[model samples]
Target chain A: MSDHKIDTHKIDTHKIDTHKIDKRDWDAHPPYVYPDYKSTTFRGPTKPLVPIAHTLSELTIPAFGHEQIQEFDNDLTINGRVDGEPQGERIQVSGRVLDEYGRPQIGTLVEIWQANAAGRYIHKTDQHDAPIDPNFFGGGRCVTDENGRYTFLSIKPGAYPWGNHHNAWRPNHIHFSLFGMSFASRLVTQMYFPGDPLLALDPIFNATADKIARESLVSKFSQKYSIPNIALGYEFDIVLRGPAATPMEA
Target chain B: MMSNKLKQTPSQTVGPFFSYALTPEQSGYNLKSIASPDMRADDTPGEHINLSGKIYDGNGEIVSDAMIEIWQTDADGNYLDRDTPPMDGTFTGFGRCDCEIKKEFYFNTVKPGPIEEGHAPHINMIVFMRGMLTHAYTRIYFSDESDANEKDAVFKSVPTERRHTIIANRVEEDNIVTYQFDLHMQGDNETVFFDV
Candidate 1:
């Protein structure tokens, strides 16, 4: 116990070295520049807000199995009209899991989610005029394959209407969520195609300080299709934090 | 790569446009404090992720009152089993860093263990806010422990390059490990959120 004693204020979870290298040199993705902190003091919560882990974080949207959220291959119950054995795409999304130092680590579990061909999520609230394909639930999941590779078969999501405006619509895209083997590895993001014009207007995509990252989600046109005659395909590479660019404490 | 061109060129927006019966505040989705500073524990000394950063809306605002949690293994290639419910020998390696209303997060934890395959133990983190139903996953491992990391089964699973996402250094100051992990709500440096 004496050997593990830690100084609360002395610990610093930043700066892995006095000579920190540019994260990109060792990293595959763009560098991350952080924002300034408003206040750096630990003040008690008005009334300690206990964790509500049961909500969004705990949701197990059920992987929806190996079929379309709406249309199943030949198994499960198809909720919506099956579009003639939809030959959408089995997009291949791959990327390395880098630490803060831009080093590639392994064993990290990666998860992904997205909307169905109809652009509607199986979620109850966001189901715009669009019908919910009790089956087309894109938000389920898929872990990143070895080699940092992750692949899944699902329809390229379409744009749907939103109440945000007189008639707001989201661009065609899929939502992705990832969790490393431990509680320390967690990430959630949406992957999009290249041609959609909504990238500029999408608030979520715009939130990032890096322009390139926002651009990374879009997939390039690929001639190689796991499907027979799919018109479009999406491939987005996500780079997660590798290691301690700095430390994890004060 | 080409798929990215199509989406950004046209710039289609992705979203949860419809308001849920639960308000954003009630939903715990606002980015209040983006930068949370923390302490790192180490013996010999080294560096770590600052464990800071934020989750922002398109508005570029740090969500206020949001919670962040992370779980991981240790430096010896073993898992942390403090929270397990006492059933098996399996080590349920996990940790938590919950910060309300700041895009940035601060953690005071040690480098996780390495597996037999030489893979360094990594940390898994999750983010929760208003109007969102899923949590993300990302791992952080030691930068200097290459020999141990080389054999980690889970570490080698990802591509060689992507593995960089979990590598961190072991800096020492006052006998404590100092590292920082800044999260990105969006963009290339975005925090790694998984679907698992």
Candidate 2:
């Protein structure tokens, strides 16, 4: 019943529509794990969460050239071959680099580092009692071919122990770094050998909440890739992103 | 939308062990192997500038174990994406550097060209460190390119108040130029990361 009229000039439609322009839908990425995991308690970034903006830079960066890679990086077997042949069960780890839709990610560069069969790294920080192999340098790099396939000849890494918890030991694993088509496409993950008893107890591997996704990190023994009496073969296909993509480290 | 049940694997810190494994170190024969982070040659053309910065965690403490990887187009804004050998040995689009004990990192390269016409001149960056399960992706924008930044589609998308966190401040001395941009993992001045 009042005589005052509503003021149209005071209203701003742009303010109400900001969500459409500002908020992005990140549907494909896996959710970040809960921070309560024992190991994450001390190591995880404790900063308050801040939302990220989806930008064209993430989607449109360049895929690097052959210059990013060098010759003879794929053959870890000989690369580690120095004073004598490395001691351990030899392994031929091979797989295809694929996208979410299973398309080949050709020419992707993959790098790997691991502990030698004696469960000791050449690094000074690795104070494990296991003897370090003088000849095994435990590192290799390779680029995906036209078919998106990459292979490395390395000895299977052995289990090592750390003081993460009382009696805690890490399972045999190899670290992988993949530079995909763009900066956003890069992924780093650890591949573990199947049937390793420490997989269940390792806090890092268990940090992945999904049981099925956690199991995916384990490489399977494949006779098809084995070099008959020369070395054992393991297959570990890596998916860089999307729904079916492999679980990656943050 | 997919179900949120599948959780990502938690990331462990790169630890002190990565010194030889990832960076340039001489403890082992193979450790000296792999890709070197050098991105420029003596004859690479363009303004030679030193890009430097330190990385801070949520507590604002320096993160010495972190490694930064940068990807940028040449001064002409062209990415060397050819399958064949390079026509000119000048441009290598990718480079990486590990942080020192002071939690600082630096890259010696030419200023990148604006990604697209009227876009802000920017460089793509990825961070890998202990604790981060996956690498964090961000971009560095030049503070001097205000006109282009204003029109850049990506820069415009960022909220005006938070955009300053990504801009590198420029300084010139002794006929040399240097740009400094700090990255904050958390807190009020947190850097703006991009989702692909």
**Strongest candidate by TM-score:** 2
- TM-score each candidate: 0.43, 0.81
How well docked is model 1, in DockQ terms? 0.04
Residue A100 accuracy (lDDT) in model 1: 31
True contacts kept of each: 0.03, 0.18
State, as a TM-score between 0 and 1, how close model 2 is to the true structure. 0.81
**Each candidate: RMSD to true structure?**
17.3, 11.2
CAPRI tier of model 1: incorrect
**Least lDDT summed over 10 consecutive residues: which range in candidate 2 chain A?**
A16-25
Top-DockQ structure, candidate number: 2
Over the stretch A119-216, how does candidate 1's per-residue lDDT look in tens digits?
Answer: 66554446356555544434333333345555455566778765444545667766554443223223555666776887677554454444655566
Model 2 regions more than 4 Å off? A1-56, A59-72, A242-250, B1-16, B19-21, B25-37, B82-86, B100-102
lDDT of 2 by residue, A1-250 (tens): 0111223234333333211221122332222333533433433434433454444444444455466455556666677566898899999999877654354678777878888998888776578999989778777777789988989888989888887678878799988887665545567778899888888787677766656566767788888789988999998777664223222223
What is the fnat score of candidate 1? Answer: 0.03
Point out where model 1 deviates above 4 Å: A1-105, A180-185, A230-232, A244-250, B1-126, B131-196
Candidate 2, residues B81-117, lDDT tens digits: the string is 4332235755566667768544688888889887567
